[model samples]
Target chain A: MKKSSGDNWDSLEKNWREKLDSHKEEVPAAIWNQIEKKLDEKKGKAVPFIIHRRQWSWAAVLLISFGVGWWQLSNPNALVDDSKMANHIQTEINAPVQHLPNTSTPELEEISSSTNPNVVSHSEPMPSHDIHSNLNQEPRNTTESIPVIEESKPNTNPVILADNRTFEKEKPASLAKEESVEMLIDIQPSQANNQEKENSYVPEPSKKRHSLFARVVKQLRQAIDGEPVDWQTLKQGDPKLENSIHQVANTYIKTEQVVQRTFQF
Target chain B: MSKTLLPFKSEQELIQACQKQDRRAQQIVYQVNAGKMMAVCKRYLGVGPDAEDALMEGFMKVFSKIDNFQGQGSFEGWIRKIMVNESLMKIRKTANRYDQDINETYDIAHPEDAIMHLGVEEIQNLILELPPGYRTIFNLYAIEGYSHIEIGDMLQISEGTSKSQLSRARQLLQSKLKELQA
Candidate 1:
């Protein structure tokens, strides 16, 4: 048996190429069905323009957050700053009052003398005595006159109850009484009315402060209990009020610490 | 005659319609070329469902990448190339297990009458009977007219390896022809 040479292999290769090149087979009809089915499957897979499930979830979350933010902005109940309301009332009280054209200076003097014997008796002409006498005599007229005094010298009308108490507490006994009387004279009728209304609505200031401290403690407890507080929403209003609340919170914390130390002792 | 007389779209028109994803035009293109493409796939994959799988995959690729055909070559050549590539890929994946070393020096007995009597189907079956490695190189080099260099690049074998494989394939086929004659 002879081994084929390279030339013989070339001839065989040529013959093989000619044979295979001329050959044509019918593709099975079922192949087209398979291909069409595959194409259809591919098309089905590709056609869905739906966002990913996670992306859709994220979009829904964002939409919900925006809706909640918008609702919070629109809701009047959401704007519950007690201190802002108090400041607004004080501003109204401190505003200048228009005196009636018919009420002359002589009439004012006569009214002052008749209604307020204390004012006439006070020879030194103390502003506090004049105001106190007028308050005692006629509440309506006192309301009108106080704004006049406020307009004349605004700082002299120092009617902040907290300030008076702190000032008296820190001062000598004699100076404390005089300063306390002066501070009382500074209380405009409108401010007194507002304070009364607030007092009626909530508890007295001491009780309210205690309740606030209790609420803060409860919030701290809840936070320790693993509930999250949205401090961002709580700190939305006036900076001054935020500062005062922060101070009160610190004071309450200090008082709690002192009590804790006393108990330990 | 009547089918020929019926208005048939030019190859360009069919291609354009296929690009637009027109199903009718795509079907028409498939009908025209699928037999030849199947034959090409059958050469590499042999006569079976594997050939059908390769053909189907090839056609799908054709449709998917129809935009890449820049009207430079004959559409049939473009389609034929895709079918060939698909067949090669399928063979590479399935044929890795059959990577036996080639026997270079086989005894050759020329059986001209037997070789001549064998129909194209018999020859194809004989080619399929060759080891997958030999069959692939044989198809690429001899039948497909790819240079040994091209076959090497396509199959990732060296050029000398492709030449040796082709020789081994021819010897195997000749021996098969002699056996059929005997």
Candidate 2:
């Protein structure tokens, strides 16, 4: 199967000779015009897309962050919306002690004040509206700067803390799909008694008529389609097959095999 | 003349303009390659209209992948390879035409006599006139001079089929020419 180098070179030379031979036709002028039109159409369609893709990702990121901020403003359980929580964490990193939750609104506010910036950055970005839009036009707000006001300390990872914590027992009365945090907590108790087992996520397909019919249809259709077909396939002894004949009936029949008497010409 | 690729306008200016999404550059590239790509595409398609479709698709691929052209290799060669690939891919989608692993030896003795008898235009036209499956294999094997092994691998057929197809293509061409002579 291994070819000699000389043979390969000879092959290349032969190909070139053939290519020269094949390109001898003068293409009609009209066809060439049509080809140009096609190219123009393609270039036109793609030009906008090239620019759009290049710019859209940044816009998408900003919009998502903005959406999160709006969602937080109305929601009481702000931490359930991870994006807004992360944005708040980033904004609050340098926030004054006055803004930090005091004895009045204590636990979360104290946690916010103490949380490390490194941990804050890793969580989802808050739905912060274009609060920082002016940063671009201004000389510098320096979001990237991470100002050296606070001394660097060994920061514990928040995700690890979140994963390790034991979730509170779900009170059946408080269980609601509308509250994501409650639903998450609700789902956890099931993992123990496992009311809905792991496979519950993809529920067992019920033997409903619609579902069974679709699966049967799909299998039958697939079985009949695409593979090689033999010329002679026949089912036995049905009346349809008993009457089925390949040859044309010499006499025309109104509905059956026999033709009725014809009228005089 | 070859060095002055753009001559009055310069191909580099046009290519750069194309990079900037210029209409004029798009027009120039289309105008320059349409005829040749059509001929290439026609070799791999069932009919002229399908060939045109392949031609359009190929040119689109050419423009998109133009950045990958290293400039060390022949520009037309690079573009031609892309166009050929596009045409072949299009052909595969429609039909799995490789029938019976063609296991026959070709009596190809350099085809010198036929080459001498036929003009380049005649030969090119003859190749374009071939049926899609045969024309494609012929072009890849004879003109591209790909080994039967390479042609088989590329077309998803056995080496024997590639060999037989090339021989069949050559035989078809010779017969067509003989008919014209008669």
lDDT of 2 by residue, A1-265 (tens): 8665335435544654655634622455665466567667876887887676535544543344344334433443332233334434544553342211121133332343344222222233322232233223344221122211111222422221111111112213232222233223333443524543431223222333234224333433343354442212321222221111111111112212211122111
lDDT of 2 at B168: 76
Error of 2 at B29 (Å): 2.7
Candidate 2 error regions (>4 Å): A1-265, B1-13, B106-115, B128-130, B174-182
Which docking class does model 2 fall in? incorrect
Alpha-carbon error at B28 in model 1, in Å?
A: 1.2
Candidate 2 residue A29 C-alpha distance from true site, Å = 5.4
Candidate 1 clashing pairs, residues 3+ apart or interchain: none
- What's the i-RMS of each model? 2.4, 5.3
Tens-place lDDT per residue, model 2, B1-182, is 33434432676666667666565566667667666666777666744667767766677666666677666666667767887888888888988877758688556333333445465566667777887778888788766667888888888889888878766777777677667767
Error of model 2, residue A38, in angstroms: 5.7
- RMSD of candidates 1 onward, in order: 19.8, 27.5
| Deviating ranges (above 4 Å) for candidate 1 | A1-4, A50-265, B1-8, B97-118
Q: Candidate 1, residues A142-220: lDDT per residue as tens digits?
A: 3332323323334443221122333344444544434434443556777777765764333234543444334544555
Residue A262's lDDT within candidate 2 is 20
